[model samples]
Target: MHRTYSLRSTRAPTASQIQNPPPPPSSTKSGRFFGRGGLGHALRRNTAGAFAPDLAKKLSQLVKMEKNVMRSLEMVAKERMDVAQQLSIWGEGCDEDVSDVTDKLGVLIYEIGELEDQYVDRYDQYRITMKSIRNIEASVQPSRDRKQKITDQIAHLKYKEPNSPKIVVLEQELVRAEAESLVAEAQLSNITREKIKAAYSYQFDALREHCEKVAIIAGYGKHLLELIDDTPVTPGETRAAYDGYEASKAIIQDCEDALTNWVSQNAAVSAKLSVRSRQLSQRRRNNIKRRSEQGVGHDLSSQDAPLNDEVSWESTGQQQDEYDDAEEEEDDETEPSKHSMLLNGDGSNGEKRGRSQEAVAA
Candidate 1:
């Protein structure tokens, strides 16, 4: 009877088995037992190789979804400001006794708050999913490496003489490799079938939910703008409302742009700092290694003093920023409230408003 041989089979081959080994076409290349693909894919395709490539592909898609969600949230924030300006116009044109418009404004603010909360929740879920996938892939790498080494050893043994002293050692190794490879394959199978499916489902649902919330936010914004446009008012009041809204939007946009720029710059700075630190660490390690190879003993503690100095400088900068914030807070508490001046029409505060208006005009 002819027996079939599977890759990484634990059975020890008899002399007859070695003379006429059963070889599957898929496992043959260059007249060798291992397949055409590299060692990384020789054992039923690394068991996890099928899903390994998909990890980065899914992460890229998730990142793109996150960017879209951020843009939508920014649009919603701008719309909230527009709605507030419209509510302000409604208050100005009506009699002092009218409170209904303010009530509507409150409802709109509450709805915006809810949308912001939803965005935060979805973003958190995205981060968790990304981290889980990365960790799973990392765990699978060592098993794949061990399997590759064992396969290479097996291939080397195939070329050696049958009566060589290494045959017994090779047989023992084959048994060990078979056991280890089977365990790794089983682990990868479970991960790909269960964990990966759950993570992908969560990300897909989160992206869809985020898009729906953004649509609802857009609808509410369009409705509010239409109400403002249709309100009956004098031409001057109408122009003034639009002018204020545009100016507010411009200021808000400038602030958002500045904040975005600041974040990008800080991120770049942090990355550069991290790279510099790693480079310094590598240099120190290389110096120590070279010294040891030359039979010399150098004081690494003294050599590392410069790295400590850089750490202290970073701490100092953080302390300075905290001090500046404390001083700004004190100044704000000592000064009269700008909002109170705008609302009260105090004669003394009118000069402050005029200066502010001049600054805005400039």
Candidate 2:
């Protein structure tokens, strides 16, 4: 049985602590509001992977125990019937054989009753724990969402404007805040999930164990019942039957109390793990995003080379461009003049073309 927990030192949270406590839940809307994917998208995430294997194992074991109990119950019932027949024979005062079956039958019945009571009580307790877990899961959802948005916005801003140290500091604060929120959400989720598993596990184990015990007792009682049926009733047989009845009555009544309460501290352990792990995962993502944004920001903010170097390159390029432009203009001017000269060649300028020119001149 675990003891209850009490916090040590009853001081209220300081302003700094509250401010720095945690990050928000990573909801898409909140992420977007905080510039994470919007809350709608965030809801779509982290829904699965919650039901782990340990829970399955516990449930499987419970099933096996139940099977054993059923088989045992059947065998015990048949044996009880045989015992009845023997009791009738004994009244006839005939053959000599085994002891009376009444006591054994009584014991078996008592055990069954006890097992049933345990079932009811244990289930009630489990229901209570489940309720608590659900309540906690619900309570934290809103806060978790709000925090996610802040973290996202901070990250987005940091990514967009990397040049400012003040912004950097502000981004860091947001990241820190988001980290805290992630932790809280994870812790809450883990607690709820783990508690549910444990509750089911406990119920299953208890039921299985009790049923197994019952089955065994029933089998033994059946064997005794068989023995009595084979035996002839005599004076001694009367005493045996009476004793069997009383014992069964007591055992059956007590079986109701067979259930044990395990006030779990498992919830706390799970909560701690959940909160820490969740926060850690988120922080890792945030760090990666932050570094990338910072790198990009740094690149953007880096100073350009001196203005003198820029001016020199510009001047050189302009000079080359001017030279090319002049050369092109000169070529254009020469093309037209060359064509006109060919077309209007005078005899003196082109003595060989005089014949062609005279023909055209005429």
- What TM-score would every model get versus the actual structure? 0.36, 0.31
Best by TM-score: 1
Backbone clash numbers for all candidates listed: 0, 30
Error of 1 at 180 (Å): 2.6
Q: How many residue-pair clashes does candidate 2 contain?
A: 30
**Segments of candidate 1 deviating more than 4 angstroms:** 1-117, 157-162, 217-226, 229-362
What's the lDDT for residue 15 in model 2?
Answer: 35
Candidate with maximal lDDT: 1
In model 1, the Cα lDDT at residue 267 comes to: 26
Poorly placed runs, candidate 2 (over 4 Å) = 1-107, 148-177, 189-197, 228-362
lDDT of 2 by residue, 118-167 (tens): 34444444544554454444334434444566567666767886675666
